[model samples]
Target: MLPNVTVNPAAEKFMRRMVRFSGHGDGAGFRLTVSAGGCSGYSAEFTVEGAPLAGDEVLAVGDLKVFLPAESRLMLDGVTIDFSDTPTASGLTFFNPNAGACGCSSSSGTSAQPPGVAKVDISSIRRN
Candidate 1:
């Protein structure tokens, strides 16, 4: 069991929309993982999958789907996903409760992830 994080209204609505809009016919939706890196050491990872492994949690919101990998779930059991649109384009933001004691830092100091969830693709795709 992982620590639970509070979900903001904006994040809940955005997550529901993203899952509904993903257009993936496959049963799987989003896979949340944790990986090494970040100033604190570990971060969370999110991905789309066709299926979820045992121990994974399937969360649904308004036809939207989000999956938490078994191992990753330990670190992000109760986190919330939020959406924000500033002068910049709209994007997903994570509000993780298991961040470092001091607090995880994003480029904008808005999003955060927990320790050890194997953030495979996200880190490679985006250079921090």
Candidate 2:
């Protein structure tokens, strides 16, 4: 079974802008992928692509293109990508509902084996 996914209005608007900006010259759509590396043993990756592969989540946001791999769709359910500009820097942020408790902490069960059954010492993590 797969959870629900909702695209935030802000992200949608940003995506639209990216489409317009890229479509004019020499750009394409955004490719969304889930790769191994995050605290949960996997992290999401985004790239620009001129086309989409088979079984991809092809969402046309204005002139921008959005592509999500079939395998990544389940984990990305109810995810929203937003863009923000701060005094430090500007970038796209991701919101995923499936993330386990701990918020990408190394001590969290997300990155542990057995899939959420293992226990971790929070105190130890804080000490480090």
Candidate 3:
């Protein structure tokens, strides 16, 4: 089954741009793979591909297509995807309302990241 994922305007725009500039023709799409990781509870990597890979499912966001593997589909359920660009960090961020509070030391009350939100820095993601 498809996950109930929400793509905010910024993320949608980013994905659209990725596919548009992929130079892979009309079927190109943004492939996103996410998993549980670190204090924020999520780690992600993305790339523009000509088509969905084996075992990947296509998720339609307006006219744009997002290719999600099985693990990503499970992780993204009821999650909101957003993009942020700032002096400190810039990239896709995931907000899962059902996520639990992080146990990391930085999350001991005065954390930069709020509970249940994972910031996937573009610099940290390997584009493949």
Model 2 residue 92 distance off true place after TM-score fit, in angstroms: 2.4
Better of 1 and 2 by lDDT: 2
Predicted structure 2: clash tally: 2
Model 2 lDDT tens row, 45-68 = 555566777777676555556777
Alpha-carbon TM-score of each model against the true structure: 0.54, 0.56, 0.91
Model 2 lDDT, residue 111, Cα: 35
Worst 10-residue lDDT window, candidate 3: 103-112
Candidate 3 C-alpha lDDT tens digits along 1-128? 78999999999998898788778899999999998787888888898888899999999999899999999999999999999888867889899898877766766444367778988877664455
Q: How much does candidate 3 score in TM-score?
A: 0.91
Model 1 regions lying over 4 Å from their true place: 1-3, 26-28, 40-42, 61-63, 96-128
Q: Give the root-mean-square deviation of each candidate in angstroms.
A: 6.2, 10.2, 1.9
Candidate 3, residue 28: the lDDT equals: 90
lDDT score for residue 38 of model 1:
62
How many pairs collide in each candidate, listed in order? 8, 2, 0
Ranking by lDDT: 3, 2, 1
| Candidate 1 lDDT, 1-128, residue by residue in tens | 43364446776665545445556555746665654456544466555566666777776654545666656556555555555566534455555555544444443454433442222222322211
